[model samples]
Target: MANQKLKRWLKVAGQLIIAVLAIRFVVKEIDLNELKTTLLSANFWWLILALAAFLASKFLSAFRLNFFFRALGLKLNDWFNLKLYLLGMLYNQFLPGGIGGDGYKVYLLNKWYGTPLKQLIGATLLDRVSGVVALGFLACGLAIFGHTATALGAFSFILWLGLIFAFPAYYLLVHLLFKRFKSVSHTTNLQALGVQGLQVISAFLILKSLGVENANIDYLTLFLITSVAATLPISLPGGIGVRELVMVKGAGYLLIDQTSATALATLFFIISLFSALGGLPFLRLSQPKD
Candidate 1:
């Protein structure tokens, strides 16, 4: 446990350093004046409206999670579920490892719901699998039209389609494998898995609406791939530079300016920070309430 905690902090430290460096590049590369002009020119109302959509997505996720827990006969309150979900995002956004937030969620599930720590972790892991698969599909689609030679060369096209198409196969295989493990929840809510896919898809839409343009098809493949990769195990200290770097790298890969990527990444982080604030109240309540 101590080792795990140390590792988490170390990852956080590394990301913070990287993020700070990335932020510097963003500031220097993008003309703050013009960036402001562009930002101001856009309709601010979409961002406002998107907030509602964000909340709705969260609600849907909570509802799906509720379905799973209730089916398993676990009793929980909506407030608790919402707060926990928010808190878990806090961990994901700020913690060092990709699973950091989910690990915290497992702890809370055990604490509040008295679930076996392992199984709670398992359930969360399963949800992540669904999300990763969803993102992979999008990335694959993005790759096909981008014209950039995939690292795989001539067979890259075939490989990309295989990967994009394999997400389903992977899920099916895992579902079957889990079924054999009697300890895993046989009553798994597959619907919840679908919800995970929708959530990522929605986020992509949100990014597009914000003016993140990827070439080829309408969306940015490099952006999706980089963002998903950065969100992996190295997100520490608000995902610090990791998210920004991914954005910069993604945008750069797609011929967007580094400054623009940096600004967008910073804006996205700010939004995430605000959303993460929902967890602050629960952090205060992290201590068991008698």
Candidate 2:
């Protein structure tokens, strides 16, 4: 127990150090005044729309996870599951050094429903994998259909191939490792697209809010790439610095304005923070009917 606790603290400390270094690098690279101006000049209505879209995406995400839960025979009410999801989000963002949101959910559900821990863990793991798969599919599609392909020159054909086979590949993965979820794989994957699509729309709205009228696809492509980086469990709470670093670096590569890209990343993080806070009120776990 002592060793595990020490390991957790070490992980958290390492994450904090990396986050600080990344933030410092990003700050040194970008024009702080330009970033401030970009943020301060954002359109208020468009930002509101972006927030709404982000929240909607999160709701779709909760629904997608619930589909996996039901497949495991742990039938939870939609409202109950959503509340649980919000609470989990809160735990994940705020308590990264301890048992994460997914860990807590697995413990609570197993305790409450007498479900097998292994099955619950698998369901949770698969839920996350589904989201990653969707992110990959959309990122690949955007790379092919947008300016990224043109920029990649000879390598653009790789994006085409990935877009064509992404889902089939995901299906095969589920068949081999998570056969129980195979029944709902198609539905969950489709819903995953909806979730990611809304998130992309949110990102686009953020760009629009910042008055980025040209090179929209380039900015969005960077946003998607940065998003994948942020999802990794290496950054500070809320992925504060890692997202900015990726956006700054990716913007330089994509020939986008670093200041505007940074502002967009900051705004999206704010929206995500607000959405995560929705779980605050649902933190007290309640026993749901079986």
Candidate 3:
């Protein structure tokens, strides 16, 4: 028990340290007053749309996760599943060393449904892999067909080659993971795509909110790339500083202005951070009685 408490304390300390470092790096690397001005002048209506899109994206993600749970013969109701999903999001952002959001869901499902623990783990792993696959696919598509694709010239062709190869690769992966649940593959893939689509729209709205006019695709592409980076698990909550740093350094590739890029990244992070907070209330309550 002492060791467990020590581990929890260590994890919380690590989370705070990483968050502080990330915030400091972002502040040093970007113009604080400029960011403040951008926020002050932001189009609130556009930000509202961005937040809605972000929330919708989470809903779509939760919906996709249901496919995995059902594949394991677990029959959680959709509303209950969403509640579990939100709680998991809370655990993910707040309790990294403990039973994480995913582990929490697995634990609850195992306790309630009496499924094999190994199968629960596999289902969760496949769900995560599916989301990453979707994110990578969209990032590649932006590189190949987004407005900046022309600027990429022959490099676009290389991206296209990668995009073409991605399909078969994804199919092989699904085949391996879904040999028995083959029918769920198509639905899962579409749900994953929808989840990313919502997020891309959210990013675009965030750019618009920050007053980015033309070359919107440039910023959008960078946002997509940042989304990919956030999945790397090497940074603080939601890849805070890491994501802002990615935009500051990578936006130039798409001819985006560093200041606006930083603003967009910051706003999106703020919006997402708020959205994640929605799950906090769920943490205070007991599981809903089915």
Candidate with top TM-score is 2
lDDT per residue (tens digit) for residues 1-290 in model 1: 99987986787677667768876766665677876765555445655554555556556666555544554456667777777787777776565554666777777668876877666655666655655565666566656666444444686677467565655575576667544322333323344434444444544544554576654232345445555665565455455666666666566555656554555555555655667667776775453343
Cα lDDT tens digits for candidate 2, 107-210: 99999999999999999988887887788788887777677787788988888787888888889989999999999999999998899899999999999999
lDDT of 2 at 96: 67
In model 3, the number of clashes is 0
Question: What's the ranking of the predictions by lDDT, best on top?
Answer: 2, 3, 1
lDDT of all the models against the reference? 0.58, 0.87, 0.78
TM-scores, one per candidate: 0.73, 0.95, 0.87
Say which prediction, candidate 1 or candidate 2, comes out ahead on lDDT: 2
Top-lDDT candidate index:
2
The weakest ten consecutive residues by lDDT in model 3 span 90-99
Identify the runs in model 1 with alpha carbons over 4 angstroms from their true place.
Answer: 1-5, 24-33, 40-42, 67-79, 94-100, 142-159, 162-164, 172-177, 180-219, 257-260, 281-290
